[model samples]
Target: MVRTPQPGTHSSTDHDPDTPQYEAGAGGWGSLRGVARIFAEARSSPEALRILAGQNKPKGMMCTSCAWAKPAKPHTFEFCENGAKATLWELDQRRADAEFWQSHTLSELRRLHDHDLEKAGRLTDPLRYDPESDRYLPVSWDEAYDEIGRELRALDPTEAVFYSCGHAGLEAAFLFALFARAMGHQNLPQSSNMCHETTSVNLLKYLGSPVGTCTLEDFDHCDAIFFFGQNTGSSSPRFLHVLKDVVDRGGRIVTFNPLRERGLVEFVDPQNLSQMATGRSTPISEEYYQVRPGGDVAVMAGLMKCVLAAEDAGPGTVLDHDFIATETTGYAEAEAAVRAMDWADIEHHSGLTREMIEQAGRIYLSSNRVIGIYGMGLTQHVNGWLNLGMLCNLLLMRGNVGKLGAGVSPVRGHSNVQGQRTVGVGEKSAHMPADKLRELFGIEPPTDDGLNAVHACEALLEGRMKALVTLGGNLVRALPDRTRMEAAWPRLRLTVNIATKPNRSHLVPGQVAYLLPCLGRTDRDVQETGAQAVSMEDSLSNIYGSIGPAKPPGDNVRSEVAIVAGIAKATLPRNPNLRWDDWTADYGRIRDLIAEMFPDDFADFNARMFQPGGFYRGNSARDRVWKTESGRAEFTTPTTLTALGETPDGQDVMTLITLRSNDQFNTTIYGFSDRLRGLEGDRDILLINRDEMSRLGLDEGQPVSLVCAIDDGHERRVDDLKVTPYDIPAGCVGGYYPELNPLVPLGYHERNSQTPAYRGTPVRVVP
Candidate 1:
């Protein structure tokens, strides 16, 4: 029987000693101090310094923080503040070894905060949950593997789900896919499923390819850049350099977000000695529009409507008719849809007047080359795919895509999220064709559609999924409806987590849970073929090599490739055709297989990896060669302008946007402070507009509870949340993820992509 997670039972109530202080800009002395504080907390070692020096460099490991593109000629100090925190966090000397596990029982560990769990340091050994003792006891690698294999083999292939994290390298991802296929199931749910699955689903329909068409060089030539829902500073701070370059070169940047993100407002590059010395910063967005949460579709449609209106005023002069006629389909339908939308409906939904929308459209019309960049904000909504489709429609109106300095760029999070998808770590086996699998590895993959994150969770709760093998990531914490997930987590028969550090997910153990310690990106991975370097594909499909130089924290810690291979060898029947041993011996063999599987993208895999900035797996859409069924880019007409459905009668609700702190990376909480947002030492706080706070009869620093508006019978609420007034749109509130994830119902997700609507979760505040 599952017990309901009581509200405020595990919430963070203690506030920081200092009051919340909003900084003027992002990535200045504050960023430096934040980084310094983390380093100090980690008790900076020589190994840490070495790892920091090599981060994002050509010869060093890629920053495991975010999937921001790296330059060909990298800067001396290539990493950003968050990147540094991610690196040092991995290189922390403190070890959660046998003693640590013995001292802390599962119940005791569950009581600790997410940040405290992370600070417990690296896992030094393979651990199996001892139910009798209510603790995790260290076990031998072979013993753990044998037990896992026995459990997995006993369960139906369809009952097991393999979850892959984006932080893994291409080699590991490729092997993971091969393992899953070999095991006769395609139940591969990945980190991408939660964040940018909408980008993939929508882009594939519109542009044939599921990746961004633009490269890093596009920022240089782009005359205008439009940012929708992406906070460049906190999510991907390194991108600030690219935006700054555009701003410095007389480019126009238009931003549309609920909050006035400091990064979008202004950025101070820490690398720029002169600017740092003078406390000077480069202004980023020329125009910032604080659109209401879940109103992106309306805002986007209004922009297209304005563009269409302009085209009507002077046909051919405004729109690229020749390109549309030649390179695209369904333009007529898209145009008609935009023209039919009423301005009042658009304004009421978007919380922006006609003049504001037209002004932004005018900027778009004036610019010869434009780049549309967005993040999870645009993708994690009920109408996420529609939001992206509308953005694509706007770009197509002016023929911005398939040209230099122009295209839709989805700023993907995680280091190798794109790479994992590229290598076929997905629920579908379309990338890993059935015939190809049969021919290459003599494996018969499942024909039926596999489970995504949402489905996997449902399966777990319903006792359909027996086992879950995660490569990395805090799966439980990253998901929506934290209370339900927490309750449903133990329903699984077996849970295997291949991880480096401790997190809250590890606490929610299954009936038989095993924690397999794996090598971090910063740790040296020495195989039979000597020190190995893994490759990662960035947000723009740029593949680069990452070689870790630091020694592994423990002798027991193994490479992800090795751990995955071990599981494969243990679970699946012995096949002469599949060389799991050889692949683990030399990851280059895995890359070789990937090259064979994806010849176009990863041809000459090992050789090209050594190149200075790596290689770009060119997008067909970028070259004006569409791979869609119609053999041309297609324009998608949004079905409706109502993004987050109609609010219930007599219910005063605010759309909630889950955010990552400046000191955090994904679910890894480095510290409580979100320096850029002027937040400190608190994670259970909500950022509401001053006017909205007053309307709700709420005061700053007042404790409040959030009740999810979704009528799922079960109450979804998180209590003891502090309300802090912020510069966000009214009828919208912002809170850190994992904490507020409880308020986002699991059933409340995007219709098309099924990505959780983490950004625009409708909820009501109560005393």
Candidate 2:
């Protein structure tokens, strides 16, 4: 698939900036330099080194950098560069003590970039934002909890909101979810509401589960793998090993993305000595299609159409009939829809010729073992739900669900976000079915669905939510429309955040703000039960033990579990039967309760965790045991790809997609350097196709401003961005998120999943 481009543009402003240039090849020396950068910034503290060495070990802390699970026997040094950076950032020697906060005014802190604030070091004590002084001061844990409890109890329960960060252990997530429910509030928002939430809500609707059905071991047997929107090299460094092994086994890898991620083109497995020693990188994607930003549906649908056409030309040529007859439904209708789909529209919207999709179809028809893997790129769109549904339909056609090496895989981002969902981090009903929750907790939790990240922001703005309590995460920086979110936050009467380090959220206060410092994943928790270990579920549903080595940050700081428990116990004095103290004393008790609540999934939860790789939460989709509406894997028809939203007369708009840089992880910025992209010093660089840049009369390093082209009431603009020519699609441009998040409107999100559509945003680029 190819689109003709205009001539390359050049102007006097094209003079090269002082930005550090990156080169091809993702690993080898680049990976080593990343580790060196971590050491240089953190001064290579002993605790950081010791803690990092134990990362991803059999009985060590789970790496929070990515949710990708480890093998049964982890290697000696399994930590990736990003994990090292995260460790250095978390285990910083400098402390955000009372003295630091005393010297820095809230106004001064607000002026500092989010990255500088993170590098200032860990929050060493509980801090309360004193509105009168416009500064934060240390507050006793009891006083902070009491003030928060009073506000929570006084407000109408429905007017309070709880935001969860799934990077925390499952125990913390479970306790927070329970605490919110016990307080009679179901409007609990979570990190999953923004990131891979479509995988949870949509997979449940069609496949009967939200988690990936395939195990990591499936990589050994799969013959062909298709990747959509996942750049494993930078996001999940360890996963590059899997891709290389697949290629070595003669397995084909096809990628569908707007730009050619260097990882997908060639990768040097840092773990592989021969490749790293000789500076040899393996070619990954055999056929790469630059599908339009919002055109995943059209591409997949066109492939499905090709499959149906082949089936029509020769019966039993492409599809599995026996599996369809007994194991699935909706085949006849879905087939008819695909047969009638217009190829011209598919090619137009997808920016791919029919030949490209047919080649993918032929690979699918021939391969007996195939796995389709996708990431937020597909789900962070208006059609996120349908995108997943269409992938399910494609997998079901081949009876791939319960097969040896074939199933659906939506690679999640956070370490235990999946487990957080499994342990009931969403609305209370998600924890236990109505009867089960009543039977287990002896209290009926709210039955109604709660607001996601987007809706929760809306509630805060509209004065529908008065109190905000976050388990962790900088929700304001993570959310869209910071100018508006910063304004909306003050509408809330109370705000409480439990975090490992101080972020911009703590500084941007509500009327009463409490920053309750908590232990990091690499910090030890000494409870009444002696030392404790928390469990986390990874991308493949493997629940493993994560034990931290470093001691708690300070004498006053509490474990996330304890902090959450303390607040809940203080607020609910009426519920005498609830044993918050007992749960805090022994986390194993909480596991027992979890097992009791989810008998089939968590049977022998405590005992099975003793095994090397922990246990797998059961998925009906994996076993082909249909819990879906039709008693079979139902087929879903995807909608036609719509053209970019119309602009005003004489307006030239380009589709914009916000992505993460190599130096960043989610909202946290390690530094300005993005070595993977050959960028440094500045993150405001906008990636544009060479032809498109010239058409707009823009040149490399040319200063530009971006404004939302839509006629939305929200006036979003990010200024002083430099344009960089890159190998992206013709009508598309790219910029890093959190920096460009201001351009995204809260209302512009996937309707079904409520996941903010970070791509396909129409924008006017001013030079």
Error of 2 at 410 (Å): 0.8
Residue 722, candidate 2: C-alpha displacement in angstroms: 1.1
Query: Candidate 2 clash total?
Result: 1
Candidate 1: C-alpha lDDT: 0.86
Compose the digit string of candidate 2's lDDT tens values, residues 1-767. Answer: 11223311111112123323345567777887888887788665677777877788767888877888778776667778777777777777777888888898999998888888987877888989888888889989899888888889898888888888877887888788877777776777788888798888788778777778889778889989988888776788777777888999899888888766767777877777898788888988888888777778878888888778787899886688999899888888877777778887787777777877888888888888889999888888777877787788888887778788889988787777888888878764655466766676667677777777898888878879888899889898889777899888877788898998878888878888888888888888899979988889888888888888886667877898899999998887566557899999999998888887778878888887746666778678888887877777778765455422333433367778898877888899888877776767888889886767778898888999998776777788899999987767676789998888888778777767778878767778987
Please give the CA lDDT of all the candidate structures: 0.86, 0.79
lDDT of 1 at 145: 87
Best by lDDT: 1
Badly placed stretches (over 4 Å) of model 1 are 1-21
- Give RMSD (Å) of candidate 2 vs. truth: 3.5
lDDT of 1 by residue, 258-293 (tens): 777789888888888998898888888888887777
